[model samples]
Target: MNTPHIAASRRTGFFSRSGVRRLAVALAAVPVALLAAGCSSAKSSSDQSATDVINKLGAVPIPSAPQTQLTPSADESHPQLVAVGSAVAVTLPSGTGTITALGPTEDLPTPLPATMPTQVAGTITLRVATKTGTVKVTTTDLSSRDDHGNDIALTPVGVAQAAATAGGTADFVVRGTFSSGAAQITLREDGHVVAVWDFNIELD
Candidate 1:
């Protein structure tokens, strides 16, 4: 009964079972390894992207011209101060706070007219501490001007309007393209200049 043929058959059967089990384990581990690798790569890429964004936003350049401070009149209750790469604070009749002009750090892909030279993107944050009641702010309250005394239109990309509490902040994102020979950017609120940032923007 223990012939060579029978012994060979038993050995073959044992090897087949063990090989199948090994193959199954190997197949099961593949997806898990790939998943881990994918997760690690995704996290690294996301972290790098975030770091780039932060660096771009944080390195706001200073303007060429000196910062200007405008009070309008001695009788005026609110005073505005303009500084490059810094937050400008003003106290309104109803509230007091700061306005930070985040200079254009990135060029947007928005379509421009033939007359437009270059389009840039920026953000403006307004923080007001109400003395008595809430202060209402709207998109129309903001404006931009170039060095040539020509007004550069600010197209609102996004806006975050918080409840103007005694002390709260609101933010706005604006996009605009300038003409050739643009030198400075002036920001105005309700027809009065609040902040000015100078730039040596050269357009061909």
Candidate 2:
């Protein structure tokens, strides 16, 4: 996939003012307490969905009875703000270069991360290798969906902006909180992820 291949695209509807009015009218018809109770119950059920991925990743690298859940559960529809994409032609800031090849996590060169913990927690410096001419780079947030079809938000630690050169490496060190289990971090531009990093973080 040279030019970034997007998974299947689905059309999501937005909530308009009229739609809100209708929903308000419908809600007003029901007892407020019942509505509150229903919402609370839904929240409780969804909270557990995120952990399902972490547990499964640990038990089976590949699930025997693997079930895929769309991010933002298909049941509870959410409008997609816009077409997910990276900043087009978002070049490096200043004193930054392009990404060529990533180097090793410890000692990196190009297209490689400079430093990363064998595991990660809060925030850390993430490095990538490109050319000696690299500078003015930034790493963006990562997004992934779990088994429950809900989007998991991830933040990078470094620069995800486009490098100075067409081919260079960069490191993104974003703060993140993950449970003890298996997961992958995706590189995002706009709302889409273009790259990925897979690892496991033990909850300490």
Candidate 3:
């Protein structure tokens, strides 16, 4: 009888419908997977952008300096000398931070002082990490003194302001016009000297 044939056809149709449903489910999941991947890529791009901003702070050409001294000493006044490419950790009023001397740059100071011409220029990167509350650090909080007892002027470069909150970090770039000879970079927070680094400059 035709009843048996009908039963066979119905079974085949059921399997076909089930397979189509499975395919639909798989197709629906693809967009979600792609969206997740896109989110990850976006985060990576954002992190890279942060680094780019820091590098652009020294976009101008830098003259070569032949010497960098980072000798450790027992004298409490001068603990350790930080090399040009090295980083030093410091205690912040609100949290902690690391300061790195990115080395000299040719970016001269604006409107060169008629009396005090700039002998050298340099840049430094500061990273602030906070866990308790929001904290802000700026180039204005820094000072530099040359071996000749000259006070070098410090200024903020790209992304001038750095602010961080709980479990967050911020990057800041600071540029300064230094005099000839070795110089010292100092950081002051809340009217207290918190950190320091030395740089030696040589010119042809």
Best by TM-score: 3
User: Tens-digit lDDT track for model 1 on 161-190?
Assistant: 333655655655566665445445454555
Which of the two candidates, 1 or 3, achieves a greater TM-score against the reference?
3
TM-score of 3: 0.48
> Which lDDT values do the candidates have, in the order given?
0.49, 0.37, 0.59
lDDT per residue for candidate 2 within 38-109, as digits (tens), equals: 467564554444345434552222212212323221001221221122111222222222222121122222
Q: How should the candidates be ordered by TM-score, best one leading? A: 3, 1, 2
Of candidates 2 and 1, the better by TM-score:
1
Give the per-residue lDDT digits (tens) of candidate 3, residues 71-94: 222122323356555555544556
lDDT of 3 at 159: 66
TM-score of each: 0.43, 0.29, 0.48
Better of 2 and 3 by TM-score: 3
